[model samples]
Target: MPCTGQREREMTAVVELEAGGAKLGLMPDVGGSIAFWRCGEMDLLRPVSDPHLIAQHGRAVAGYPLVPFSNRVAGDHFRFEGVDYHLAPSFGGENCAIHGNGWQRRWGLDRLANSSATLTLDHAPTRDLMGQWPFSYRAQLRYDLRENGLSIGILLENTDTRDQPVGMGFHPYFPRHAGLKLGFAASSVWTNGPDHLPALRVPVEGEWSFAHMRDAGQEPIDNCYAGWSGSAFLRWPREGYALTVEGSPELRHLVLFTPPGQPYIGLEPVSNMTDGFNRPIIADSGVRVLAPGQKMEGHIRMTVTRC
Candidate 1:
């Protein structure tokens, strides 16, 4: 959102993809965010009717991406290799940089096909990307329309001459209903402090466990999960449909954000945790250091079916 202190690009045109009975809408200039995803008459990703709303809060659209790194970086600054870097706060945290640079900067439409489109973004330390994330990287978000749903492919390349900490994530919003249920398996949960940084790492159990399908109540849950099964299942009994999210192994973190009384649920597949940079040496933090010319890639697929 603009209140997050990142530059909000003006809304350009939306690129669309249609295959079988599914349709995917993407806004390349608006942080490369997805405006909508629909299967037949059913909205799969909580379609956003107005693009302006997405322009204001790029994350307000159906979904947006987290690139180079994901989640909070703590203090709006981070020191790497004895050098300090300053970043703009996102998600409205005054001192913490949240969600990465991809969701706030405009992305170029590299290639467009009938059922797929690719958006590209190049970040340079000198250019600042409006947030001054100190790294030179290339990110590409590819959206493909499938027969029953869609898939997103993320490719991040380290263009800097030295090693750089890089990771990627996807934030997708799903319509919430009283009869909705979610199922997933995770070995650990990273509890957050009042500031939303990682406070504790605890075993998944009780309310934190989703090993089997359970009602998705109107509860407040904003924690990151680790050791996931690489997938999650969401079903709506009353709606007679189900959705599945599959992620590549590179996506080691799963974040669930369910705010009370909100109409949508944020189910994210990410590569790192909140303030992961702070614990740079901890493998559990999910940070990956890439050498020059090296790249990392991951996939997230969403498939829907009749119940």
Candidate 2:
């Protein structure tokens, strides 16, 4: 038989492993910002260029510009490592700065066979950053996708000879419209001002308790939970699935933000609490400082399973 000019192309491409009759779209470019990651057949992880997406996912990572720094002078102004650094206000502020420099830059892509992919981003302390938070450092974000979930690992290295304060956090926007619920095991809660920066540290209060399932619609937040058990349990009852977020013991804090008028919720696993720069350093708290030529690395794994 002679073949006609007709050909067929499938609509859905299998980007990664398959199980339970569902194909995973693990590494296809979703949009301009995020690489589309499907959790087996559970849900589609949409990556967008908009910052609001961070708010939409309930827990998308936010940094380099977390919240916004309103006051800044020439050279990005601040002092660290025994030096006065200046950083041009990326968001235009004059009083102080917010979030370190990381997210705004475009990261490089390194695909690892089929099971995983790596997103390598670099932040070389600019004269602006140097003038504000004076220190030479490198930041990297690595995303590894698997059959059941994805793990985000962050590494920050000190390139200068002096010790500097470093604060890193993960912002994940979780789905909220469904029967979504959040639960975690933690002991301390940091007090913050109306602007959402740390004001004090106190014992965990009622409702703030996350040892049990709590409806997403019932609570409002922009606060951090400290002395965590280093774990959190998240579930979408409507979807019949749950995700256990496991962090390193070094990752002692988790920030939960329930913004007004958003469909998603944020469950951020942070190495330090908000306004970390201005907050009093707990006996052993604050960003990890490494000696020159030294490196520090940590992991935050999110494992999802159907109920």
Candidate 1 lDDT tens digits, 1-307: 4543344334646788989888888988778989888887778787443332322353447888888888888788777788777876665425666778787788999999999999999988775464647779999889988878789999999998988887789988899976889999999999998888889899999889999899888889999999888999999888888999999999989999998887888899999988888887677788888999999998999989999
Note the residue pairs that clash in candidate 1. Answer: 76-95
TM per candidate:
0.92, 0.75
Q: How well does candidate 1 match the true structure in TM-score terms?
A: 0.92
Question: Residue-pair clashes per candidate, as listed?
Answer: 1, 36
Quick one: best lDDT, which candidate?
A: 1
Per-residue C-alpha lDDT of model 2 across residues 182-288, encoded as one tens digit per residue: 78877778666655556677787686777787876645777778788888888877778888889887677788878766666777777766644443446534455
Model 2 stretches with alpha carbons more than 4 Å out:
1-35, 44-81, 90-96, 128-133
